[model samples]
Target: MSIFPLDHRPDSSQISEFFQEVRCAAMEFVFPPACMMCRSEMPHRIFRTAGCTLCDDCLGQLDSGHGNACRRCGAPVGPFTIATDHCILCHRENYAFDGVIRMGLYRDSLRVACLMAKNPSGSLMSRTLADLLVDTQYELFSERAFHAVVPVPEHWAKRLIRPHYAAETMARQISARLKVRLATGILAKARWTPKQAKSPPVQRRQQQKDAFHVVGAGVQGQSILLVDDILTTGATADAAARVLKRAGASRVVVAVVAVSPPRA
Candidate 1:
């Protein structure tokens, strides 16, 4: 009378075992027991320890504050007073976010890792760096309040060219840990512009002016953790925060994989 088998499904224990084996195999295949920062052979799991040899050294260096960092923008500053908490430009202007949190100083191994993460040919390294960024930022702001994860939007053209920027992946991982939803479309790029790495601070801000729009209804009265790969001028983050606030988000805090220290 019954077309279905009496014992068609596997027990929960069997399924769990199967998945565990598959996960182990996938991890070994993907990571290959190498130091994620330098690809050197790793004796132990870096993920469990927070970092391996190469990354550990770099993390230590980053904490030393060797860079001339602007207090307000988190840009590298040369000579400035922390009392103002404002770089020259920020002293004259305003930013939308409450503050910026960075994972490491951008240089040496950190710079190399960031480049790899941004490259289309560098998926494995990029994914690893993204995971690390998420973990580190979460650790730094363990006590901060956040309602959701929102990533800086790339232009549709750039998205088409580089389908997976590390920021989106990083935000998703952090959101998972925070058990909050990640909103991708809350802020969008309204213009296609050239890179801002070499642009002056004023130029950078001007270039991005009116370049973002908040889609649909506002995310009012909610705290947002805005994730990005790096913070250089703070222009991009500031622009995004402006739109997020305009759309009704209560507060915005930035989290970046790296902070390029200001040049002397």
Candidate 2:
């Protein structure tokens, strides 16, 4: 016997799906889409489904950090290292976050992508990058269904200048893909801090002191996945994770598009 019943008609959800499909087709016809990366015309299937503007060649260059890495901080480590604890780069300083998952090391093509993503004009690239992150790390995300995904807060001065927050945009895509709640305004920058990229490692912790705080509630005993564009000295992530832990979050995991190699 047919479980759905012989006389069952298409429900409201089915009708909505049909209309959405028609609308997409009409929009595609009206405005032919071009690749966001190289500006090449995208295939109909690729345009409609993947929502990626990068050509296959460019997409293939997005290296995934799959080999030996510091289990805690996600920094690339020597394969022969026997230490089970934090990597050398993370050993001295304390980090509140439980773990880190980075897409790749910051260099070459990935570096260029990160630079482009920082600007509002590169919104399309940001979306494509988010898609790439989720696709590459789907298994890790699936392992623990995170209670919430939060973007590392940008300072108010920077927020005023930028039209959109790239980290938040990426976090939204990740939250959608992982089927987790997107929590914004819960954590925020308490004060403007010097850019970590320009500061020396020894001075990073002091520069980021009291830089972040929690503004929203209901996070008690929940697991959080903090999102950022790049992980450098781990200063910013550590600062934010400290505040999150104080707010009662059980576990805070860091996720970023790229991780900078340790400075010499």
**Candidate 2's error at 228, in angstroms?**
0.8
Q: Work out the TM-score per prediction.
A: 0.76, 0.85
* Clash counts for all predictions: 5, 0
The C-alpha stretches of model 1 lying farther than 4 A from their native spots are: 1-32, 44-72, 75-93, 121-124, 137-140
| lDDT, residue 147, candidate 2 | 93
Candidate 1 structure quality by residue, lDDT tens digits, 1-264: 112356787678767876775676578667666554555665444244532334556445434554444445665556545553666656766789877766567887678878877877655655566566556556556767788899888998888988577778777766776787899977889999788878998899999888999888858888999988888878898888998898889988888878876567
The residue pairs found clashing in candidate 1 are: 68-76, 68-77, 69-77, 76-262, 220-248
Candidate 1 total steric clashes: 5
lDDT per residue, candidate 2, 159-190, as tens digits?
Answer: 99889878988898888888899998799998
Ten contiguous residues minimizing lDDT sum, candidate 1 = 44-53
**For model 1, what is the error of residue 134's alpha carbon versus the real structure, in angstroms, after optimal superposition?**
4.5
